[model samples]
Target: MVVMKKMMIGFLLVLMALLSGCQMSEVYDTSVNLCIIVANRKNQPDFSDSETLNTSLKNVIDSYGKVQIIVPDGAPYIQGTYSIEEPAKRMSSRKAADWRDIQISSMYNILTTTRAQTPEVDLLSAISLAGRWLDDREGEKQLLIVDNGLSTVGLLDFTKNLIRVDANTIVEYLEEKEAIPSLSGIDVTWVGLGDTADSQQSLTPVNRKNLECIWNSICIAGGADSVTFRGDAPSTGNNSESLPEVTPIDIIAEEPMEVPAKQSRTWWLGEEKCQFLPDSAEFVDIDATKSLLQPIVEAVANEDLILGFCGTTARAPGATEQGCQELSLQRALAVEKLMLEMGMDMRRIGVTLGRGYNHPYYINDRNEDGTLNEQIASANRSVIIFSLDSEVAEKLLKE
Candidate 1:
């Protein structure tokens, strides 16, 4: 009878141990709101970080979470949503691994079906859709964006000369259209900011910074809790032309130039002739500078023509945008002072500003070996005369 009593106590302890284990597992169970956006287009490379990405996948697989996938801004947007549920009963490690396999497979299948959903990628619209989806979720929210932040469509279209526009201006426009997302309380991470694939022009350092700043502004304006730019940038990008065509942004530096003449509507008075002292806006030969401006003055000499002088300088080491703008302003001012002395009205001279390296009328002055071509760069350092009557002039002047 004593032996039988001891056996009952042992059985009770075993059952208690099992119950304790179950409680611990339940305590650790967590759910996450994970939304991933993949921009599968011609201009963006694939998100090719295997190790880190697999780890992210594993975390979602091991927990009770909501997964959302989006391919944005085509003729129509594409999205897939799935929920991860915990098993009702505890299973062995092998079974758990098998469960993760099933989950990943299902997710992969959904991604496979999304490839043909959109013709091009529109990141803003995707973010808007993701924000709404996350609003429905009931857990810690996270969004992972996998693409070059350069959007080819919608209000933030780079093709529409949006690259030259400032971030604050972009935010204002987005707000006006109500296109910006409401991402309140959500953490946003972008994997690729300026990483571009072919049929797309590569971003310069300034262009990349501007690209990043614009997107960051948009996300912050949309009320995101945190905006993080993180990346495992892939060395190799997809160069397939079969993907939807993304229009290349026309960099002013790469545009063709026409010679300035007495009757010419546009004037590109280059540095070789204007002869400004090196690193100084002071004219090397005052008469030479006057001669260069004479043609522009002759062309826009009439009452109806308002001339806008934009000064450009060659790219230098460690040049800031503000500094470049200041230099451009100084150079244009030097010419403006001369014009004012020559009896041109200040009101008729619409813009006398420095463009620095931002507005290069001449093509890339950098050699294949990454050295500056002095001759090419000299051509780039010049003044562009814009007659306010022309469409291009009207556009820049916002008249």
Candidate 2:
């Protein structure tokens, strides 16, 4: 009895030790917010196919039991709960060649064949969709991308490979890849399988707008009914280098144009005797009057800007005041034309009206000479330049 007791005690101690070791070695269920980046392989012919690409994506998504897929634009964002068991299995060796190529092909075929959107357009759409995934949540998240090329991480370069692997393995691979350049305006980790996470998050604000325009043009070309197809199409209108020449401020003023800028500052141009009415009474030169506002117009063009044309209204004896109002409107139209000619994108422009002597810039309309100073005359009337509020501009632009 004493010998049996000793043996049982030893067995229990060994079993407990083994169990503790197993517990310590096990990877716990890591609940992490993951940013899944899907980049279109620019080299693939069918890289934009939505159906094919989505199918493959669905397969990858299905393999993970704890993940919830999130599609911001068309679908909700996915929340993933990963378990250690999933990563234990290995992907088939045959399908491991160029995971990026396969992904690109799958996506391209879907969009091209079914959606009828072009590769460039399709790519942009996919990128946009990937970006939208973040709309649902805020704060820190792990960015997992399956694409080609590399991005910087705080001046470091991290390149990675993509194959059939579990999410945890993918995370491990990125950490070991290289020091990466910091992605400005965004905080996320980047991981690539066969290539670096090349979906550049460092795009300049201006470049982003241009990229969107390029995709829009592609949509027009592709005849894709879905806006998604339109968002990513290749730019046909202007290349980055071929951007329209920014007209000088004087030139813009001379042409009577308006422009939009990305920044915000109030620019008010004052001329006292600014002839509120056109020089010709019989025929008001609306366009000609607008020509005088070239400086403001050009400035707006150089900077992402907006324009508000205000004119003082004094009820003259006859149709003079009315004539002046009409002339002001004419000037506004003229400015719009010059803006277009100067290569300022019309999409950035906005128009507003300031009528009458209701709000005058200067207290005294008359100059020291006591005579109506031509400069001081319209000085009471002026145009102000400012930033286009996104919501207001968007509404007007849509209208």
Each model's lDDT comes to 0.72, 0.36
Q: Could you give candidate 1's per-residue lDDT for residues 1-399 as a string of tens digits?
A: 999999999999998766543421223245777888874566666665534445555566666788888876465354767877878876655566677778777776675445524565577888988899888878678887777877777767887878778999999999999888989989888887787777677777778888888988999999999998876766465645656666667654434467554332566677767777877889999987777677656555564666788888776556676786687678878887887777676777776667677652436777887778887888778877777666546544542
Q: What's the distance in Å from true for residue 373, model 2?
A: 5.8
lDDT of 2 by residue, 16-101 (tens): 76554331122324333334444233221222333433433434333321222222111222323232133233343333334424
Runs in model 2 deviating more than 4 A are 1-262, 269-303, 313-324, 360-362, 366-375, 389-399
Give candidate 2's error at residue 375 in angstroms. 6.0
Q: How well does each candidate superpose onto the true structure, as a TM-score?
A: 0.56, 0.27
| Model 2: per-residue Cα lDDT at residue 253 | 12
Compare the candidates by TM-score and give the number of the best one: 1
Determine the backbone clash count of candidate 1: 2
